[model samples]
Target: MTSAAPVATESGVPLRKPRIGLLGIMQALYDHMIPGITERQSGYAREIADRLADVADWTVGRPVKDRTDAEEVMREFVNADLDGVMVVLLTYGPAMRVARLFNENRLPVLLANIQPEPQVTAAWDMADMTYNQGIHGAQDTANAMVRADRSFEVITDDWRAPEFAERVDRWARSARAITAWKSLKVGIFGYAMNDMGDIRVDENALLRALGPEISFVAPGDLYRGSLEVPGAEVDALIAWENARFEVDPDLTAAEREDHARMQLAIEKILVERGYRAYSTHFDAIGEDGRFRRLPLAAASSLMAKGYGYGAEGDALAAAMVYAGHQLIGEGHFTEMYAMDFPSDSILMSHMGEGNWRVARDDEPVRLIHRELGIGRLEAPPTFLFRYRPGPATLACLVSLGGERFRLVVAEGEVLDAAPLPQLEMPYGQFRPDSGVRACMDGWLAAGGPHHQVLNVGRHAEDWRVFCRSSGIEFVQV
Candidate 1:
């Protein structure tokens, strides 16, 4: 089956900046109203808002003193569709009112219980006492949220503290990612590979649990679109390929044109449908409906252009790739190709669908034609190269049957090794922190799928935060 339909533009994963609603709160204590306490609190609120502006698109709401004021600002946040909210306690505020609004939105929140001064000194006056009244107000807010049955991450420290800023920044990043997830769209152009139960995914479950829209495409639609692409577009793609790749003498012009058309067709689908990630299976594109022309080159090219691409209709792998890229900047589709005990490493690769952007820049990806043994059709061209050597991590989201799912993660080093001449696909050698055998055991223990997302840096921490934010089980092996 095939029907047609796309991350940020760059060689790295682009950050989805969060639009945060910033609110400062205080209770109306008319009896204990201290002069300049409100003004000082307002100034502190401005400072917090300015700090947040460094990491997020923040809108500072007027310091709310009562339910009427809180409701007005809450309405603005709702209308703006904020990814998350940050509530700063200027003084002991009415937690019931604030908690109610937060619970209704059901978005992630940072309950910042920050004091302007790191410490109180002998010279401290009533104004200082009034300004720092937020000290115990944090407990009030926490109690209110607990009563309202709402969850929030708390930072109870001075804004000037390095740790406070770091924690807040991390929360903002996590919120921005959640925003991206809600609007994500993934395209599955064919059915899952047969009999590979481990890699099979339930589209509905994925959509409900992870908040991405899934689109099923028919193969014929893509093929027809490819044929309709203008010859000029194909010619431009060929020219670009010749300039970018180490063209193989064995790759015929006709083969290159066909591959280019496939790339263009896929690109059109992604652009039109707003898909950020996609998957394809050879069996659905074959000549006799068993396999069609190999789309290895097209897949590789798309991956280099910042689109997540997975082979054999691996929607999970593609989505993970997209997520990893969004979180870091670069992600490659890979599998546990083979274990090389002799070198205490594991080899990772797919059928010529590696991201060329992750390959060694000095050694451009080589274009080559290969008979991938999938169909009886003519061999297709593929980009042949290995990923660049660097510290990396592998991440996989596996369905543990029913609606349960778990994330499997492992940190590793991309070792420098000679590519196997016999293997036509792009390959990389990796040495896990736990060694090859132990890593394999861990993978098996976690029930890790063969297909996963590989990225260029240690992203286990980020993945852990994401899993927590999304309520997914995490098994870091």
Candidate 2:
């Protein structure tokens, strides 16, 4: 069954429509007698597909007429560049042979085994009423894929049960959700820091599994744009704000003016480049008359409002994008610190950017500051904070969890744990943020790999979908 459209009612986040693929349901009658019913499992399989059609956009049934059927299905999946595919096991015929066909194409396949609810009086009388037909069919399909070293997402909920429709619908929706990830695109600005150089990660590795793409930019480009701000640009900034969130009363006059200018610059870049997501530098200011802010707060705010951002991007941004896509929510930024590190769980959270659409709205959020004396910003120590607004899948662009490239994907919640208490410690507070604690828990418990990235809204899964399309590992949490 296909899932219902994701409604905002489930959360403040909007529902994303997934472009999904459907595998013909087949009745594997290798050992069981063919039902007196006509045409094996063809009609039943189509009905199952019809049920999903009501909720999603899909093309169903690659009837295994021959090896060509598998090839045709694979071709369609690739050409359509679909997000996810649902394979309903009706029979273990040539239909089963096609499971790996799409898997190799990196399409996440959902192994669905659903039987019609309410067995008919004739179902059993027919001498071939096989309730386990659907169940066993899927198991065998999974077996075939596994034999070929393939992995798949399976939904074995009883469709004949009272809540069958709801369960099937939700899975269908989730499958679609995963599909959305396949089309994710991420934007990158600024180069990796030569210092703290250890944070580099392998973006291609993530691209191999995730579907997001990086848009390269120079630090000076943003700085140049900031200095060259114009009146028309300012107006465009307001328009972006309106699209992002409702402007609120809490914003100070100074905040509004600054926001007005910053928003214009960002909007110019995003609109000009056709980017829906981004990751950028936090300390790329200029010397003398020119200066720039890393736009950390801005990144946080936009991501929370449904856009995605990876700070220092590289690989970490991509990882967070994947986690956000998987978790179906925003991913916050996080870092590793021994004392604050979770023996168990930890999540990350941050108040959004001062100029971001979400931040302009001033939704209730905790406010934290940089640890005194940790490191001084060359610019004024103002509200230019680098925070991940929600729990996320942490990642890096460097390799070996170090300088080359690595992505962090996490799943967790926000916590109100107090910030580090006064003590003889490192310059910056060496403790974890309350939000980070919540996220850490999610990462450890969910077994979502840890590190850090910017995942703040419902689109992260789309980022994961992008990862799959791009051939990056979408580690589960």
Candidate 3:
């Protein structure tokens, strides 16, 4: 079972800043990063502390007691065990010296702080100077860290800014999120079906790049699980068929009861396997001795609608399934399709788990049949509405050019329209996107090699950060 618990890094989730060491330089004010003479300020400091906790499970340590000696802090930051560090400054020792130490350690840093007091023998100006000290501490930390030649970000605002605070929280959360998904596992079922060019995915590259582990799934396991469906659980299939086929009448009791079994079996397989997404070839030709029990129309329909069933069981398609689960928070499964038509809209859907992403304004998908051994059982299917234009990203988990590369990355969009005709499945169903033909053509022309996973999402400036963390290539299309 391919499971997509954590969203893929490249898709809207940013990669974590790896591991970091947090250092709060508060020796100037009672050994606290945020020094406070009043309770309100102290409470603000606590909020900042809570934010750190929200961001990462970090190691907090003392800074240089001697304003002139920050070598120890720098050493700890640069120590191989840590990835980066956050510093809460309450003092402004020699900025240059502190800066040099950080440069040597070369770890990422974040400047965090609240107000601090200043040295005041003159009562007339003491309180004001002290308040200024806290503000300066945060700034000095930022300046020193940046001057030291390390990449650093800053967050000085206190709890008053709840929304912005959450943004900072997301940064720390991003770190944990990347790590959590990096060590995650996804299952891949069956082998790639024919005609879907090699996506050339390199597992090592993926680990080096994305951090997801691909587990192999057997056809027998999937098939065996299908037999375990219970007698109850008819809601899913009935709802699907009814919503899918826009006919005035609904499905009969017998059809609903029967389809329910298949849906139940499908869900059970996912549950038992701990899979977030998967692709498998249910070809009946016995090419690999795998037999076809029930008409895949039912299973395929179930899988495409939000379920993850890729035709040919190709890796690239599996990656697509993975993307749907991660980015869309669901999985979409299907075979490579050709498109050449001019329509303002189209659908991107299947009859399974990931199908929910289809434009609700378009059409719904319906399942049809074909010979299993030959590959690709075709029938017109409706998915929500037309294609979403503008910036989009396409990926693929493929093997070719002597290597298997999982997606890397390509940016594109739904063009004017795809070039294809209305499908001919008995029930009124239509293909999703019309620009696929052009997409494939452009990909082949650009030396994309073969099969790839496709998805659409809003782009951001930090996209590269997303790629680096995910372990896939962020190639320009």
Candidate 4:
């Protein structure tokens, strides 16, 4: 049978734009006391929404003046299925009028403490007080939210400030990440590595805390699928790989074809089943000699194409890497293997699996053969390269038992390094902003797992915001 189109050709994860609902709040008494106060303040809300137009998918609601107006507007926001709500206090509104609605709805809230005027000056008059004096209202609402045990973020600044827009954009991105997390589905082939305690997680707890659906696949199914992959597709994949990466001359034609068939089969399963992330146990795949070679290259290629993959059936790491991809566009699956005390750098690598897209520009990725001493298996073709030297973030999601997960993150730099031809795996040397000793101490103290996702750039604050929105604990070292 003819095979389906290759899923590996897709370049990056397609993220849906974050949907945000903007609502303005004001006291009902203002309508009678100041004839045009509500209408004028509503104009300020529209201006702020317009400024944030490019940042998110905005659904602007009419200014809410009393319980009646608040209920109606809140209904609109709910109907819009927003990722979050930006509550703009247009004027001095009573907290009781809208605080309960926020508490009950439980949507991630951004209390916009922005004012129309940047500063009070000689030109400031009663009109400025009527329109720009919304900070006190924000304070009142925040106090009520705290008493009611609700989570929120308060952004205080003049709406016109560049920083204000940047902060809003960050919040919108975090909201989008949270939305993606809620809809994530991860697949696992075979069980986790035998007696691997650190990577073990309680699936029920994981689902409750992180909102990912886990689907387990039998190893036999993968073996059968690999056999069914069309020879034409396998040849095409081998040609594509040869063009992109440096194929070792020692790799035989049969070896390349077998690896290509396995890779195609894995990609087909993931794409057809709508799995955003996946994991496989090496020992299990090697068991019974169903797979002559482990599919390490398959994992590497999938990761390069923006599909999350964790070696040794690490489902949590798989999901976390996917989340990192959604937030930062690229993420690499890795673990700290050794520490260089003299250089203050930690050696990071995995068992012949990593996103080759993160390789240094100066070096070409090499697809080489690897030997697995496990269960009647031969050497498989996998990638070997040096990670890009730049600022990066190392992050992991660890379960703190039932319904509790903490995101441990560290901002670091991947030091300039040459590929270790002797190691025969994708590797990098990372120096944390905090010294190696301190970073290690802090990471261990925060219950960090060995398997972590690395992404380019410093994203601790983005993760902090994401954790707050999703109710996960954030620990940055």
lDDT of each: 0.77, 0.47, 0.44, 0.84
> The CA-based lDDT of model 1 is what?
0.77
TM-score of each: 0.89, 0.65, 0.56, 0.93
Q: Rank the candidates by lDDT, best first.
A: 4, 1, 2, 3
User: lDDT tens string, model 2, 406-444?
Assistant: 233444433334434332111112222334555456445
**Residue lDDT tens for model 3, 1-477:** 322122111123233344546565544444354445334333434545555564455665555545454677667555645644656554444355466666554344556554433234566464455444655656665676556545445565543456545544544433333444454455555555556445435666555544555667665664554445433334544554565555323334544444354345545555566654455444522343533333344434443434444444554455455544433333334323433354422233333223334333345443322222233432212222333344444444434333223233444455534423453221111223224455455456555543333445533212333333333344443
Which candidate leads in lDDT? 4
For residues 276-391, could you state the per-residue lDDT of candidate 1 as single tens digits? 88987777677435334777788877776667777787877887887776666677898887889888888999877887777866677898878777745568898888878888
Which stretch of 10 consecutive residues in model 4 shows the poorest summed lDDT?
4-13
Judged by TM-score, which candidate is best?
4
Candidate 2 segments whose C-alpha is farther than 4 A from its true place: 1-13, 25-43, 49-55, 94-103, 117-127, 130-132, 160-185, 195-198, 227-258, 286-289, 322-327, 334-477
TM-score: model 3 vs. ground truth: 0.56
RMSD from true fold, candidate 1: 3.4
Q: Give the per-residue lDDT digits (tens) of candidate 4, residues 217-270.
A: 888878888889988788778878878889899888878878888888887888
In terms of TM-score, how similar is model 2 to the real structure? Answer: 0.65
Supply the TM-score for candidate 1: 0.89
Predictions: Cα RMSD each: 3.4, 8.3, 9.0, 2.2
Order the candidates by TM-score, highest first: 4, 1, 2, 3
lDDT value for model 2: 0.47
